[model samples]
Target: MAVPAGVAAVVREMQDRLDAMPGDSPLRDFLSTYQRTTTAVGQAITDGVFADGEWVEEWDVVFAQLYVRAYDAHIDGGHVPRPWRIAFDAPADLPSLRKVLLGINAHVNYDLPQALLGVISDADFADPVLLGKRKRDHEAIDGVLASRVAAEDDELTATGGKSLVDRVLQPLNRVSSKRFLREARQKVWHNTHELQVARLAGPAPYDVRLGELELLSAAKVADLLAPGQVLLRLAVAGFGVVLPPAA
Candidate 1:
């Protein structure tokens, strides 16, 4: 609905900072993609897209150490029988070793909270910023149903007690599309990546896995990091992944 602007991912604010910087500034190398990410993330949030709290932040953290692994893989994977020239590309400047080390402090300052501020529902008891999403979604869908703008599309349209039209009006069920969810998930992972990788180098001495980071299998890490990706999973889990207490 009519949210009083600035209530979400502050894309303009972020881009303005990037625009004010010099083109050759080392930050420029990462700024375009970084700013684009916030715009994408802001739109996703405004449209009711959402994901686990840590996902977008994680995406940023994942980026921090990914290239290092990719480069190593480019070298080692070539020592194989076929010797496929699996080239790995990266931004020339890449996030500064310092920026990556710090997890691009700005992303941690904004993205995760913005996602929550936009998509959180009343039932998301842990978050208060989005309590209004329930009301807004209700008014939006009520207006749609009242105006008869969005009709059933037949493909996978619900066929029982409540049709697509009925469900669209549910206050607690904010509408979401695969595309939106994908965007939301990306934002979360990006931010989480930043957070996790930063923590990997933080002075904390140790981390709580499953709490701070998720453990990944070696093969999965390879696919995710795309090459040499060091044992970020192992690094984060200086301890290890812990199962929750039985209910």
Candidate 2:
């Protein structure tokens, strides 16, 4: 499939997948939530929510294409990144929340840095004024995501039937979601710089660093599959994976 041209195209692509997926398909867990989030972000852009709406729109499109490519690759029996492979290969019986978290872990932790690199050139990184503007716009996304937590929780509960424990923990989950997203994005900015430096060095160095990110992201996703409260485990262990020092 052609890469989505804008946020609206991205939402439509996701919605098409959702419509095609069976109710019990594990992939639906993430796609449905992601579709909703993308719609919200699109609306925010239309509402002039960011200082640089055009930049945010470009970044959003680039960010989403990574996930879309991975999903398409998996479906086409092609090479899938280790992080996404873990998320996609997860058993169907896994909780919807866990499945969604798996997708989030893979996409946010693994795909985000590369996406940042896609939009922010090395020269842009060197310009403090430009970089600050980019960073501010990046953080603006946190507000959009934060606002969706309670509603997303309700959607998840409505579709999958949350346990009583989960129902009681709704407020905590909302707070934790916001916190982790912010933390993850912060790391994404740092990791993007690391990747940018590697890119400046050469394609070989960039590839090696990206491979390391893929491994670390996959490991984090695997950890989430283990027994424990997902949010609490994320809180204790922290969200987003870090890049190893440049070789």
Candidate 3:
């Protein structure tokens, strides 16, 4: 699905916060990495949302689909999705766009494989170490998602229905998350693991995975840049289209 506009605002807000951090901020590098990620994803969205002189409303959807298909299907033995969450009626300046991008990226990585089960092969699905990571990540991520769902539910209960999370974190919310996790385990992780067992598991598919990693890393660096010139550079490099350069 296409990312929500709320996500764009979320990233912009986080971009400002990251800017306020001191040069000496201990987590500056980590933040910078994410910043680049935000920028790239934002740019990708921009490309999709405003592509070829028209508003292609479902750009994020196409992009995410392509990404999942491209996934190596060999990460720690399974795919892990990273989905985004946005708060509504957020403070104007803090749009929280960055986090949303991260979330979608997460969801794609974690949740989007079985949907393309035909494209990937069974011989590629079996690896023990990798399979283990898939399980652990699911176990851990399940908690995070449950927390959000529960928190949203609790919010409504406490507010007598005043909370967005509470209202929206309904049955559909939990079902999708569980469904994605189950599919990834059965189709990508377990299948890959089985492949590992049937034949000799080879060295890691580092090159392909690294390329995908770099795409995300570049996005992180691009997101934290100042408004004028840097933003233009990012746009041109990422989208192949130009806007007025920073004044």
Candidate 4:
């Protein structure tokens, strides 16, 4: 499948995938929420929510392609990233929330930096003015994601039948979602810088750094699978992985 050309295309692709999925497929959980979020993002772009709406639209398309490619790879029996493999292969019986969280873990922690790198160049990074605008627009996405959390929770509840415990923790979940997305994107920016440096150094260094990111992302997903309060655990451990120095 081709990478989407814009946010509207991204939303449509996600919806198409969701339509193709079986009703009980765990994959639908994330794709459903993601589709709605992407729709909101498209609307935001239309409403001039970001400083550079065009850049955001381009970046959003690039960012979404990473997830789309992973889904395609998994479905086609091709090579899928470790983090995405874990998420895609997770048991269908997993909670809808866990399934969605797993997808977010793989996409944000592993795919996001690469997506950032795709659109942001060495010159763009070096230019403080350009980079500042990019960062601000990147941060602007947090508002989009944060805005969808409550509505997403409601959707999940309607589908998955949340427990009383889940109801009690919904407020905390909303706050945690916002906090972690902000924190994760901050780390994503740092990781993108690390990746940009490695990319400039050469393919060898870039591959090594990317390999380390794969491991860190996979490990984080594994950690997330442990039994506990997912939000609380995420608050303590944080989201997104740091890229280690190239060996």
Q: Each prediction's TM-score against the native? A: 0.28, 0.95, 0.27, 0.95
Q: What lDDT would candidate 4 get against the real structure? A: 0.86
lDDT-best of 1 and 3: 3
Off by over 4 Å in 1: 1-4, 7-9, 40-211, 214-247
Question: After superposition, which runs of candidate 4 have C-alpha atoms over 4 Å from their true positions?
Answer: 1-5
lDDT of 2 by residue, 23-94 (tens): 777798888889888888888888888998888889888898899999999989999999999999998888
Per-residue CA lDDT of model 4 for 65-157, tens digit only, reads: 999999999999999999999999987777788888999989998999999999998989889999999999999898889888889989878
- Weakest 10 consecutive residues of candidate 2 by summed lDDT: 1-10
Q: Candidate 2 versus the native: TM-score? A: 0.95
For model 1, the run of ten residues with the poorest summed lDDT: 80-89
lDDT of 2 at 86: 97
Model 3, range 183-208, lDDT digits (tens) per residue?
33343344323323332433354233
Count of backbone collisions in candidate 1: 27
Q: Name the TM-score of candidate 3.
A: 0.27
After superposition, the stretches of candidate 3 with alpha carbons farther than 4 Å from their true spots are 1-104, 107-148, 152-169, 184-205, 209-247
lDDT for 43 in candidate 2 is 84
lDDT, candidate 3, equals 0.35
lDDT of each: 0.32, 0.87, 0.35, 0.86
> If both were scored by lDDT, which would come out higher, candidate 3 or candidate 4?
4
